[model samples]
Target chain A: MTPKMNSVGVIGLGSMGYGVATSCIAAGLETYGSDIRPEVCARLIAEGAADASTSPAAFAGRLDAVILLVVSAAQCEEALFGEDGLAPKLRPGVPVVISATIAPADSRRLGARLAGMGLPMLDAPVSGGSIKAGKGQLTVMAAGAPETFDAVAPLLDAMAEKVYRTGTQIGDGAMVKTVHQLLAGVHIAVAAEAMALAARAGIPLELMYDVVTHSAGNSWMFADRMQHVLDGDYTPRSAVDIFVKDLGLVNATGDSLSFPLPLARKAYELFAKASEQGFGKLDDSAVIMNYVGSELPGTRDN
Target chain B: MTPKMNSVGVIGLGSMGYGVATSCIAAGLETYGSDIRPEVCARLIAEGAADASTSPAAFAGRLDAVILLVVSAAQCEEALFGEDGLAPKLRPGVPVVISATIAPADSRRLGARLAGMGLPMLDAPVSGGSIKAGKGQLTVMAAGAPETFDAVAPLLDAMAEKVYRTGTQIGDGAMVKTVHQLLAGVHIAVAAEAMALAARAGIPLELMYDVVTHSAGNSWMFADRMQHVLDGDYTPRSAVDIFVKDLGLVNATGDSLSFPLPLARKAYELFAKASEQGFGKLDDSAVIMNYVGSELPGTRDN
Candidate 1:
C-alpha cells in the first residue's frame, strides 16, 4: 500500500539514512533523498529515490514529513535552521522526525524550537543499525503529540519494524534511546573485554564464540559484534566513534543527575581510547584489538 | 535404562549440590549426599537421597562417580584430600567429576592428583543454577579421557541437559568455564550499571527493564537478574560474592597469562566493592545499590 504521506525527505544519506530513504521508496512514498555528497544523492536516486537534491526548494511545502537522520542534535539543528535549511520552506505543521541519537535535553529543546515555528516534532531515535534500516526493520523509540505521531505514521511504518511510543513528552524517546545506548555501549565494551580474556587465556576464538553465544554470557551485541572480530573484518557496520559519542551522552546525562555510572564511564573510556588510537573509524569490535595484540586485519598499522 | 553407575555421591550439599544429588536420585542412581550442615543433609535425605552423611566413608569406594559441587578449587581439594577426605577411600578407576568453578591450572593439578591414585578425573564445570540442577537440565562443560567420558555418559545424561565435551585435555572444561565466568560477571556488573543509570535518569525502573530486555543491550543475565531489581528483591538466587569469587578467578587466569582484561578487572572491582560494603551475601543485583541510593529492599543499611 502507498504510504499516506505525500512526500518525505531524508537528510543525511549516510549508511543508516541511505537505507531509511530506500525503505521509504520501497514502501511507495514520494521519497526525496539529500546528502552533502552529490554522489550519494545520485546513488539513492539511481536506487529508486523519487528525486535527489541538496536544495529543499523542489519539494518545499509539498513535503509532509522530513526525517532528520543526521549524526547529532547540532547536525539536526543545522539541517533544519541553517541558511539552506528546510525550516522556512516546509509547510506549517509538518512533522519533523528527529532520528538522531541525541541527549534527551537536546531533543526536548529541539522539539520546542520546532514547535515554536508551528511545526510539530517527533523525537524519534532509531536502533538496529543500517542493515535493519535497509530491510525497513529499524526500531524507532518515538515520543511526541498524538497528532504529530499520527502525521508521521506512514513514514515511520515504512522505515521501522517497531515504533515505540515512549511518551508524549518530546525528550522521552531520546531518554529511552539514551538508556539503550548505555547498555549497548557497555555490552560491546564488555564483549571485547571477554573476548580479550579468552584470547589471552589461549582459548580458541572460534570456540569462545560458540560457547559464549550458547551460554549465559551471551548478549545480542556480543553475538553480533564478535562475528566481526572472528572475521577480522573491522569494516564499520557500526563505528567505534558512535559509542564514543553515545556513551559520552550517557555519562553526561548521569552526571546531570549526580548518578554514578561507573561501568558506562569505563566503557566510554575504552571507546575514547579506541578513537584516540585511531580505531574510531573501524568497526566497534576493533575494541577487542585493544586487549589482544592487533591481530585484526583493519588495524591502522596494517 | 538404569544409570551404569551403582552409587554416586555429591559432596558439599549446599543449594546446588543438593539439587544435583536429588536429580541423581530422580534418575534412579543410588545417590549419597554430604554436607557440613546436618540439617541440609537431613533435608536432602528427606527429598530422595539414599543416604546423608558428613563423612565420605558412607559411599566413597562405592560411588562410581563423585560429583564435587563445592565453592572453590581449595574446597574441591579439601573434599578430596583433607583428613577423612574421599581420595583415600575412593576405589581405583572411579572417576571424580569435578564440577566446581576453578582455575584451569588447579583443575589440571586435581586431575593429576586423581590420576596418581589410579582414579580418573572429569574436569566438568556446570552452569545453570539450582533450579536447572534440580530438573536435570544443567549444562556441563566437560573434559577428560574418552574412556572416562564413556563410563560417565549415563550419569552425565542423568544430571545434565547438555554436556559439552570441551576437550580431552585436563582443565579444558575449567578453561571454558573460566571464560564463561568472565562474560557472566562483566555482563552482571554492566547490567547493574545500566539499571542504575536508568534509575537515576528518571526512567522508571520497570520501563528500563522492559526496554533493555527487548533491545540489543539485553543479555541472558540482564533479563534474568533485572527482574530481581524490578521486584526490589535481594534474595540471593546467586549472591554478589559469587561474582567476587568468579571474577577473581577470571582476573587471576588472565594475570597468569599476562593478558590485559581491563573490563573483567573493572567488573571484579565492582563485585569486590559490593562485597566490601557487606552486600556480599545479598543477591548479585544488589550491585545496583552501589550505583543508586540504597533504596532497594535488601540494602545492608536496612
Candidate 2:
C-alpha cells in the first residue's frame, strides 16, 4: 500500500475544519491542526493532535496531504502558497487536498499551478455537515489524477463514508458541491415561503410544519430546517451567511456556463437581504425571519 | 347521528374518485357514481355503485352526502352546484364533501351557495394520494360547521387516518391544501434541479440521489419521487399537470395576500414549461427532462 503515509495536516480549525481534524485523529492518523486562532491550535494539540506550528516553515516533509478547510477561495489561496503559504515550504511529492467549498475555477486554476510545481492536487469538497465529519461519515467528492487518489487512499477511507471520484479533472468536485448547495438553498427558501404563508394564514405553525413534513408536500430542507422557525431556534448550525457564499458560487458558475438559474438568483437575493438585516451569523433557517419581520413563533431564552 | 342517512353520491371515477366511492360502499352507504365517461360509470356499477342519475333523483330524501372527488375545482363546481347541479336536487341536510384540489376562495364561495340551499358543506381536500385513498389511509383536512363534521365523522374516519378540523369555515381546509401543494411543487422542482446538476457533472445520478436523500438535501418529495427518475421510470404516480394545477392554486392564493412567492413562482413556471413541452401527462419527475432535455437517464421510453 506504498507504506501508507499516515501523517496529515489540516489548516483552519473552524467548524468544518475542526470536525475533519478530529475525524482524522479518530481515524488514527497522526493529525496536525493549524489555524489563525491560537486557542484552536492549542485545543487540537490538547486533543491528541501532533503539535502543529501555524507557520508553514515547520512542515517540510511530514504531511502526505495538507487539507485546506477554510472559507472562501481567497482564504484558500492565502492559506495555500501565499507569502507564508504551504506550497513553498511543503515537501514536493505530497498532495494538497482542497476540502473547502469553493469555486471550480479556483480549484482548476490552483490545481494547474500546483501541477507545474510537481505537487499533485485533489479538489475535494465535503457533504454530511460537521457532525458527520467528526464521526468520519462525510461524503467527499474528489477529483484529481488517479495518482493523487492512490497517494492518499488510506486517509480518505478513514475520513469519509464514500469518496466519489467524479472525473480526472480538478473542478468536478467543486461543481457537484455547487449543485448540492443550490438545491439546499432553494429548498430552504421554498420552505420559508410555505411557512410564511401559513404564518400569515394564522394556522398553528407547529401543526402546519408537522402535517406538511409528513405529507407529499415535504422536502428535506423543510423537514430538517423548518423546525428552527417553529421552535424559534436561530442557533447557527449552518448560518444564513453560508448560502450567501454558496449561491454566489452558483451565480458565478451559472454565468460561466450561460445557464439561467432564476431560482438560485432569487434565493441569493433573500439570503443576501437576511445577511444584510444583521442575521449573517444566525442559522440558515433564520432566513425565514426575513419574511415574518419579527422574532420567530416560540423562541425564548431560558 | 342524524339517522345515519343511507344514500350518498360520489362523482368522478378516476383513481382517487373510484377509491373514495368504493370506500363509501365498503362503509355500507348506498354510494352512487357518475362521470362524463359512461365506461367509468359502468365499472363503478359492476363494483356495486348505483348510477348517480337514478339514485340522486329517486333517493333525494335519504342521500346523506354527495362526495365530489373530481380532479379539479372546475369539475367539482360543474357536478356539485353547476346548471344541472346536485346541490338543488338533494334534500337539505346532506353534506357535500369536496375532496378535489381547489382554491380557498372558490371553496368558500361554493360553501356559501350550498349553505343557502340548507345543505352542510365540508371543504375536505385529501392527501396520501390514491393508494392511501383505497386503503382509507389518507389524511383529510375538513373545515365547516360542527354539525358538518359530526355528520361526516364516520365517512371521514373511514377514508382518512387523520381528519384535521381546521376551522368551522369551509375555506380553511382548502387553504391548508393550497399551502401543502405549494411546498410539494417547489420541492419537486428543487429536487429536479439538484439531480440535473449532479447528472451533468457526471456523478452517477442514482448515487447522488441516494446520498442526498440520506443527507441534508432530502425532503418527502425527494424520498417519495426521485426513485422514478433514478429507475428511469416515469409512470405518472402524480402527473406534471398536477403540479401545474397545484402551483396555480399557490399563486392564486399568494396573489390574494400580495405575498411574493418568488421561489414557488419560479418553480411553477418551470413545471409550466415542462407541461407545455408535451410532458404534462408523464410523472412530475419528468420535469427533469426540461433540464436534462431528454427522457430520464436510463429509461428506454419517453
Candidate 3:
C-alpha cells in the first residue's frame, strides 16, 4: 500500500538517524532531515533530503507524521513537548513517532504530554542496527492509541520490516526495547569473554573465531563483531559509548521497577570499565581486548 | 569414495552414537554397536548392526577403526585404554576416534596413552545437538595423526557438515569444544537473564521473545530455545545437566589456563544454581526460571 503520510521529518542525524533518513527518501517519503551538526544537515540536504530546521517543530503543522530519531529520553521530551516543542506546532490530531530506545517511564510521560496537546503519539523504538536501518528492514517495538498506529502506519512501513504492537500503553515499546538492550549487552560481553579465554589458552584468535562460528557457542554478536578482533580494528560501527547509554537505560528501568537483572548489571560493569580504559570511542567489540589485556594474538595484517 | 575400511565399531548407542552408527552402516561399513544397556544393543542389532561383544577390545582387533561416543572423559578413557581396553587389543595400528566433548588435558593424556600402545587416537568432539546428529549434519572437530584422518574419512563423511582439523594433536578437538561451550553457556545465561527481566518488568514474555529474537539481541540460543519458554513446556531435549557439564568444562579449562573468565564462571554458576533448584532434568531453557528465591517475577506458568 502507498504511504498516505507524505512529509517525513527524521531528527538527530547520527549514524542510525542518517541511515533512517536515507531509507525514508529511498522509500519515496517526502523526507526532511535535521541534526545538531550543520555539516551533517548539509550532507543530508546534498543527498536529497530537504534542508530542514533542527527544531522538531519545523515540520509540525505540515507533517502528517514525525519520527524522533534523537538519543535519550530527555532529548525526546524536549523535541516533542518541551518549550517550543513540536506538540505545540502540530495540527490537533497529528501523529508523533518516538523511536529512541529509552526508559519506559519516559515514554509514558512524554506520550501523555503529547496526547494532552491533542497529538497522537506512538511510542516506537527501532532495532536491527544501522545497516538494517539503511535497508529499511528495521524492527520497531511500538505501542499507542488505536488511531495513533493507523495515523503513523505509512511512515512505520517505509522504515521498518516489523512493528510490534506490544500493548496499548505507551511505555510498552520502550520496556521491550530495554529488554532487547539487556540481552544485546550481555551477549556482546560473553562473546568477548569467550574469545579472550580461548586466545589466552593459546588458541589463535582467528582460529578461535572460525571454530566458534561453526560451533554451538556462536552468537550474532560473535558472528558480526569477531572480525574486528581478528583485524585488530576497533573502528566504531557501534561505539562503546552506545552501550554506556543502553546499559544506563537498562539499570535505570531495572532499579525503578525492581527487576532482578544481576547478569545484565554485571555485563554493564565490564563495558563501563572497558569504556573507562579509553576504548569508549572505538567499536563495542573492542571491549574484548580490554578484558584480554596485553599480549594479544596480533591482529590480521591490513 | 566408498570406504575401504570395512569393519567399524561404534560404542555408545545413545542418540548421537545411534546416529553415527546408522551413518556408518549407510556408508557401507561392517558396523558393530555396543552400549551399557542390552536393549539399545538389541535395537541396533535389529536395525542391521552386527551383534558385538561388550568388549571394545574384541572389536578393536577385528575392526579397521573404532568410534567411542561415551558421555565423559573418564568413560572415554575407560573404553579406550582400561586394563582390558581397546588400545591393548587393537592390532598395534587400528585408529580410534573419540567423539565425546571432553577436557583437553584428558584428551592429551588419552592421546599419550594410545601413543604408547602404538595406536593412533583422534580427539573428535561434535556439535549440532541430537536432532542434527540423527541427520548426520553435525560439526566434527578432529585432531590426531595424519594417517588417522585418512582412516576416519569415510566415517566422517557419513556424519558431519564440516570437520575442523585443529592440529596433529589429540587435545586440539577438546580445546576447541571447550571454546564452544563457553560461548553456548553464556548465550543461554544471557537469554535467561534478559527474558526474566522482561517478565519481572511486566512485559509480555512472548512479545519480548519475538522482538528480541528479531533484534540485535538475537543469538542461536535465543532463537532455538525461547519457544519452550513461550510454550511453557520445559521437557529436556538438552537437559540442564548438559550446561552444568559443558560450563564446568569451560571454567575448568579457563581456570587451569589462568584465563580471566568472569562470564564463563557466571554462566556455570547460573546453571549450577538451576540444577540445584530441581530443574536438573528439564530442558536447559529451564535455567531462565532460576532466579526463584529473589522474588522478582517468581516463575512463569510453564
Candidate 4:
C-alpha cells in the first residue's frame, strides 16, 4: 500500500529541520516548513517548500504528517501541545515524528499525549550531523507502532539514508539515541583529551592526528572532529553547547533509571565546562580548549 | 646498504611477545625467544626460533637487535639492566627496541641508559593486539636517532605492517603511544559504559552493538571489544589489567607534564575498579561488569 505521508510539515527551520524539509521536497513530497525565524522560513520556501509559515498550525489540518526537528523536548512540546499547538488540529491518525534527541520518558510522554488526540507518534532521532541531514543521508533511529512506521515510511525514506527500527515501543528509539549520545559525547571529549595530551608532550598535532586516525585510537569523532582542532577552527559546525545538552540528557536518563553513568557524567561536565568558558557557540571540537588552555595548536603566532 | 639487523632476540613470551617472535621467524630472521615461562619458549623453538632460552643474555653478544615486549617499564628495565641483564653483553651500537607500553620518562631513561652502554635505542611500542601481532601486521609507533631506525629497519619490517616514524627523540614514540592509549583505553571503557547503559535501558545488547558499529558512535575499540560483551565471553583477548596499566601510564604521563587528562583518569579508574572486582584477568570489555554488576546480558540464567 502507498504511504499516507504525502504532505509533510517540519517544525523548526534550523539546520537539521531545514534539511529535512528540503529533502522531503526533493523526494517529491508536498513539504511545508515552520520556524520562529522568518528568514529561514523564507529560505525553505525558496528551496521549494510548499509553505514557510512560522506556525505549523497554519496548515496543520492539511498536512499528512508532522516531523518535530526542534532542539529539545520542550520546543517539541511547545510546537505540538501549546496554546497554538498543531496536535489537536492535525488530521486524525496522521503520524507525528519527534526527531529531537531527548529523554526517553519525554518521548514516551509526548507519544502518549499525541495518542490521546487520535494521532500516532514516532520517536525518531536523527544522527550524522547537519551536513548529512542536508544531503538527505541522516541515520534515523525510530520506534513506534508498526502502523505509525508504515504511515511515515515515505517521509523517513526522503530524509534518511538509513532508518533503524529500534522497537515497536515509542521510547526505544530515544533510549537507543541517548545511549548513542553517551558514546558520541565521550568520544569527542576524549579525542580532545588525547590531542591535548599529545600537544603538551610536544608531538605535532598533525602527526598525532595522523597516527591516531591510523591506530586503534581512532573513533568516528576523532577522525571527523580533530580536523577542526588541527585547523585551529572552532566555527560551530556542531557547537559545544549541543554536547552539553545531549550529554546532560544522557546522564539524566541514567539518573531516571537509577543507573550510574560515570563516563557520560564526565563528558557532560567537560562539555559544560567548554560552554561555560564561552566556547559554547564554537564547534564541539573546541572542547579541546578545556584541556589546552590558550596553547592550542594552529593558533600560535608562528 | 645491507641492514645490520640479521639476528634478533625478543624478550617476554606472553601472547604479544610470542606473536612478535613468530612473526620475526615468519620473515626469515634468526630469532631468539626468551621468557620466564619455559613452555612458551619451547613453543617458539618449535615454531622455528633459532633458540628459545629463558634469558636473552644467552645470545646477547651474538644478536644484532633485541626487542623487549615485556609488560611494563620495570620489567623492561629488569630484562635489560637487572643483575643478569642483557645490555652489557650485547654488541656495541646494536639497536635495542623497547616495545613495552611505558611512560615517556621511563622510555627516555631506558634509552639514555642504553646509550651510555654504547647501544642505540628505538622507542617503539606496538598496537593491533596479539592476533595481528601473530600475522606480522602490527602497527608500530617509533622514535629514535636516524641511524637507530635504519639499523633496526629489517627487524621492524619483519614484525610490523606499519611503522610510524613519530620523531627522532627517544620518548616521542612512547609519548605518542601513551596518548594513543588514552584514546584506546577510554574508548574501551566508554564502549562498555555505553553498552551497559543500553543493557540497563532494556535495549537488546546485540542490536545496540549493531547500531553503534554502523553509527557515528563507532570506535575501533567499541567495534572490536563490544563483541566480547555481546557473546558474554570474557575470554581475555586483552585483559582488564592491560587498560589498568596502560591508562595508568596515560595518567602518569599527563602528571609528568602537569597536564590534566580527565577522561583518561576516569577510564583508568573504571578499569582499575574492574580489576579490583576480580575481572582483572577477564577481557578488557569486562569493564562492563563495573556498570552491569550481575545483570550482564548472556550471563543471566533464564
C-alpha lDDT score of every prediction, in listed order: 0.85, 0.82, 0.80, 0.90
By lDDT, the best candidate is 4
The reply for model 3, stretches above 4 Å from the true place, is A1-4, A56-59, A81-84, A294-302, B1-4, B292-302
Q: Predict model 2's lDDT versus the native.
A: 0.82
Q: Tens digits of per-residue lDDT for model 3 on B1-302?
A: 32467788898877899888887777677888878887888777777776655665555667888888888988887777667666677776778898988899888988888888887888999988778777778899888878789887878888888998887867988998898888888888778788877777778887887787777788888888777777767878788898899889888887788777888788788899888988788899888867545332324353
Best by TM-score: 4
lDDT of 1 by residue, B131-246 (tens): 99999988898889998888887679888998888889998899999989988888888888877776665666776677777779899999998888877788899999999999
* Model 1 native-contact share: 0.70
- The pairs that clash in candidate 4 are A236-A283
lDDT (10s digit) by residue, model 2, range B133-251: 87778888778889888787767866788887778878888988888998888888878877776776566776676667766777788777788887888889889999998898899
Q: How well is candidate 2 docked (DockQ)?
A: 0.63
Write candidate 2's Cα lDDT for A183-211 as tens digits: 78988988888888887776677778777
Per-residue lDDT for B19 in model 2?
84
Q: CAPRI band of model 3?
A: medium
Model 2 segments beyond 4 Å from truth? A299-302, B5-7, B26-29, B50-61, B231-235, B292-302
* Model 3 lDDT, residue A221, Cα: 82
TM accuracy, model 2 = 0.93
Better of 2 and 4 by lDDT: 4
Clashes of 4: 1
